[model samples]
Target chain A: MTKTKKIPVSLTLASNRDKSDHLAGFLSISPWLIGFILLILGPMLASLYLSFTDYNLLSSPSWVGLANYRSLLTDARFLKSLEVTFTFVFVSVPLKLIFALALAMLFNTGRKGSSFFSAVYYIPSIIGGSVAIAVVWKQLFGRQGAVTQILSLLNITDANLIGNPDTALSVLILLVIWQFGSPMIIFLAGLRQIPIELYEAASVDGASKWRQFFNITLPMLTPVIFFNLVMQTIQGFMTFTQAYLITGGGPLDETLFYAVYLYETAFEYLRMGYASAMAWVLLIIIAVITLIFFLTSKYWVFYQSEGGR
Target chain B: MHSNKRLLSDMIFYVFVIAIGIVMIYPILWMIASSLKPATEIFNNAVSLWPSAFVWENYPSGWAGFGGIGFATYFRNSVMITSIVVVGTLLTGSIVAYGFARLEFKMKNILFACLMATIMLPIQITLIPQYIIFNEIGWVNTFYPLLLPGLMGGQPFFIFLLIQFIRGIPRELDEAAIVDGCSKLGIYWRIILPLLKPALVTVALFCFMWTWDDFLAPLIYLNDASLHTVTIALRNFMDTQGSTSWGPLLAMSSLSLLPQLLIFAFFQKHLVQGIATTGLK
Candidate 1:
């Protein structure tokens, strides 16, 4: 913290010259400051403005106020994608939390090789969102895949799992669920932070393992649970890769997620304006959901310590 | 509580947990085993726990340039992009995270909020616009677009995470440095950067894996086969019609996963910390 250029903390309040010095003090943080202006802040505001325009890259964006929004409200594909995305988040997020929580509880036994188990479980989470893993999933469930070949053992010759509309979405869901390692690992960490003596005391009080889990672990883990739920929910809503690479959002759009459809609309069809509008709506939806979660957090989220609960 | 019932419940829990683990790992294990098996042996053999032949030559065949060109060059591209992204993300993201975490500034809170806000915006809306922007800049087929975004706070999540970690460090340290006539830059360089090693390592490792595994960005930007990342290379191992020599593709994919594995193997604890502290716990 040695100064080549120092802003004196005791600068006189009576001088306009000190303000210029403070400005210089601010100028030192130019990397993030300039980046925010040039990249993120600028693009975000532009995206908002772009949402109301008819800019399709070839022509100048003419202001068409609220037209994009109006059309999107009735756009069937957009609505379908909304439903698909909602279904995805609605199903996957809760299941993810539950599975992750369960896995964490099991691993929290402080077993030997626990670290290795944790790492192994986390490996899928690392690559799960990528298109490569999704592609591997596509191949695994393809007609000539391991799953299909396994099914052929039962003489079910026509079990094309990835192609079937009924099963395709579920496959993606399973993929999402399989990557429970992120939350599971986080939950394990949270569980470790919880004092083990509480569980030991509960056992001494003759409480069963399930009772101890319900009575002790659940309440203690709520804050971590809440955080994971919000993050995973947002991530689940924005899922694109699995459906994109696997089903291509096909077999009658069963797997056509909001982001995938938005990507298809924007990139495949050059509907940047419509896509921008969709992006805004998505932003609003996510904002509202986050706001709701934050608002309700006071009611349920428990922070443990000498601090508070 | 009934002791017998409790015992039965624990037994059931263990059963349930083990069952779930098998199902969870089965597909990935299947991929590994299949990649080792010969082409004819893939389906002819039952989908069991392990592969029989363990033909390691699939790695070389797969790495050898496909269509008279192979994954050798593609692996290089993947390496290049991943390395660039790693450096870019650490350099830019740490600087920005440092700004938000330690440095006081004008509208600092507002700008940090804006960074968080970008987290939820779908990348699709930007893809075509960014693509056209890149096209106009004559960078559509170049690695610039693929690599440069990482240099910005394009990845806000890691920045936010580092900010949280930075906030955990005592400000008194910086104040002490100030008393010793240290500059703010000196505070960041000596006090903050060294202390922020765990978070920085977490950020760098995740960036490496993320950029390496990212098919979409490279898929969109690097259209030239010569410039293809591993993901695109794996895709090219197949055709539009589906089902041709995927064994080698899967084998090469197994190879592609090596970087991530190496990352995890070396930095397991930091990675665990990352998973735990990636703004959740």
Candidate 2:
């Protein structure tokens, strides 16, 4: 963690201060450096190594030479987990973003008590992922749950959302959509940053509200939308708590998320090497997905600072 | 006629807003209502907000949790864990943020970039290795595994947040302190730390909420039922057997929502301000 620095004699005092400044900086940030080494960097390298080997924690890791990655090609459960995670991300992210954006627009109308309602709406995102919430959700969609009762009132057939394999994943997606608060808040903030003058000018030009929204508002919000897309996609992919607690990846493994599967492999099944490989694959997938988003962002994500067209 | 039309539109919009608000909060309201219903009446009256009978015994019975461990233990464990973790996050997050925000050090840019990168890194990549490390040290089944990493500034998000905040403070303040014979640490303590109260509160609030609501870490580390968090304790009530007491489970579940709901209610402004300030950046 050391580097060489050349200092001119004319700045001797400043150079002397530079050495002390470096020392102070290191001292102040040493906790993060220590944790980064021990918790982050150490585990990262170890996982990378373990991804290439076979180990079950009791024995020494024996190098398997890409065996883990090779095995994933034919591993049915592994493939299933990937499919499930992709489905979760692809379905939940857009729905959550759309809901968030719509709510943000609704709350951004300068209506009275909009902030209070916004805060109330943000409550689910605060506590929605808890084991308690997951349990509540499980019951709410259970055979005798309120959802069933409501549907019964509407003359729809009774169905158990959590117990039925075909509809179990949709329940989880509904939970994700329910917690669109954080993004809504961010979208609200982004809406505030959009100068009001554009909307006023559009109104003066006889533009309708929808026309003003598309022509003036949506373009200005592309950056924030792009930001939410990447963040929520990552979050959607990493979602584990609800599936782990509520679904247990069950009703025929219909909801076996990647993280849930990874946990089962490492701890439940004690296949550390295989789990590490799965982890590495997940990392690569997320990195590639994020890279794609960044690469594709140029065309759609407009910045006001760049003089929006 | 135009003004009347405008008033009508505003009224419709307000009605729409209130309808959505009910959709957002109905599940929670249902839980609270169900908690007050008799066990036999829970599912029968699930859709109704008014209970046929107010079962006051549910709260006490739920408090006397499964196997007699009680919800009190879980609540206390949560409090102890969250408080320590919050203190550690604020202290370590602020100190490290100060370094990144103000100080020039070797490899500063690269280290800062790594910090930012790790903020987006999925926890799965490091999960197994960290588990092994904690296992080797015999920190399994203890709060150590849960709280220790936080003490070492393991939360990159909080550090990044506090860095953004500290960076916004004028450098002239630090310069003045230095001229008045303030050491670097002195300036951090006397000048910068005071100004960082709002950000610190934000960090503390987030730390408390996340740790309190966290299920995976406690479920993994604390295998003992007595050592479980409220989240895990709630899970305990729903045994695989078909004999789950819905009255007590929903009661405890409603109680579990209390702390966070209270925090959000009181700190509504701070929470909104924090997210707005941090997000827009």
Candidate 3:
């Protein structure tokens, strides 16, 4: 209680000021910070701890000690979902990245009303995963769908897309690829950020357009490209909505993604503890993949910022 | 740059882009056309760009008996939820963001970093505990769970967005406010708020869209038919629990899509900016 009301010593003064500021800051950010700790981080920690337990929502989790992790090692549905999600991630990420970059380059040209075109292409990304679009996709590809109608012109008929399990997943992939605008817009910005002088200098150096692209443009845009790759990869793995509304992981579990399985488990069955473990596993997978990117980033992610931000 | 080869490549590029555009746009175009097509002609004109006869009443009929309620009611519900959430998030999130951005405080970095990391935890992990928490609080079917969170400091994504945005504004504004005897809250309200229109618009647009399009939350919490949001109500109609009609179903969807489509059209500039800011971060 001997603390001075007005301390001249820097340590005491700074400490007192910090105490007030600390209390003030904690009080100020208490809403999200508290929610994060209590609602989010607490559960996140619980999920980590719960991953090793034999808990259900009905009872206290027991110290089963790596049983769930061990169980995952042998779980067929979990493994299949892992495969399904990986297939989705691999297939969708490349298609989206390629389509997005290609579209950006297309819109990059000085064409009349290019912004309008960019905007038009962007509509799908906005309306994405809505039951409406999925329903539209459903109608457009049903057995007697538009696909058949188009085939009627060639005297062909009765070929269905969504009914085929092999092709059912492909339709979901197409849906993912269709919403390429947000990423494409990012690519466009990256394209613009490239120095016009670099391209001009390359042209003067007798570099072909192709050579200039490979040697200069690619190097400059590598960081953005890498960023998009990681972001898209993680997002692609988490694909749920399109699969959920479109196929319902359908035509015999052809489209059952990890997240869809997780959702079904968590909400549909109310198997909270198992679902929590599943979520943590997904996090671990994402972490490992992101770690790989971070490790290999030095080899490829060419950050042009002042010592890479 | 216009060598025959480069010109040819540019032409090829245009064609390639146009092809991609067609691929991206064809489904949306077809969906709109099919909505106008008669039930009989829907499959008949599937690949055809133009419908032979437009059943425009298809919209009204398609939207029929949305959860035994009119599509208008559900639409109103969506509008209500979106507005409340947007305004609520704007007020609280921006103040919290300003505090994080400008305030000098101990453990500030630790707290903020913790908030940022919370962003990485997928929503599924939190859904169970959140559901139980709500159920215990007897907010099970109320707007409390959905709406109240926004009135708190929103998701970290928006907080981080506002924090980044607030940084670009000069610190001198806050100092000037203090010199003029403005309180900390006054600086946030009078000085910072007015200057933060673009960022606020960005946050508002996102809150509106996400809340509007949110099907999952309504699906989980809402049990009472009268209280159903458009997303859940619309989806419920698709499944019978009674005889389901496809024509009215598609019609109902179109009605639901209209508000969002209009919002997208009006605030696309802000939408693009918000997304760009997210990407840049």
The best candidate by DockQ is 2
> Tens-digit lDDT track for model 3 on A1-309?
455555568767788767776676666677777677767877667677766776556677677776767777797878878988899888988898898887787788767667777877888888876767777777676677776557655885447677788888877887888888988888888888888998888888899978987888778888878888988887787777667776787777878899888888877887666777888788888889989998999998787874642
DockQ, 0 to 1 scale, candidate 1: 0.41
DockQ metric for all predictions = 0.41, 0.72, 0.53
TM-score, chain B, each candidate: 0.91, 0.96, 0.92
The residue-by-residue lDDT of candidate 1 on A91-200, one tens digit each, is 98899889888878778776555677767777788777765576578876777676777777788656678898888887889899888888898898888888878988
Docking class of 1: acceptable
- As a whole number from 0 to 100, the lDDT of residue A136 in candidate 2 is 78
- Per-residue lDDT tens digits for candidate 2, residues A1-309, read 122353556468777899999999999999999999999999999999999999998999999989999999999988998999899999999999999999899889888989888998888888898877887788888888998788878887657878888889998999999998888999999999988888888888999999988987899989999999998898888889999988899888899999999999999988899999999999999999999999999999998888767
- Candidates in order have lDDT scores of 0.76, 0.88, 0.76
Q: What's model 3's lDDT at A200?
A: 88
What's each prediction's TM-score?
0.88, 0.96, 0.91
Ordered by DockQ, highest first, the candidates read: 2, 3, 1
Query: CA lDDT of B110 in candidate 1?
Result: 73
Candidate 1: residue A61 lDDT (0-100): 84
Q: Is candidate 2 or candidate 3 better by DockQ?
A: 2
Candidate 3 C-alpha error for residue B48, in Å? 2.7
Ranking by lDDT: 2, 3, 1
Query: After superposing candidate 3, which stretches have Cα over 4 Å from the reference?
Result: A1-20, A53-63, A148-158, A306-309, B1-16, B241-244
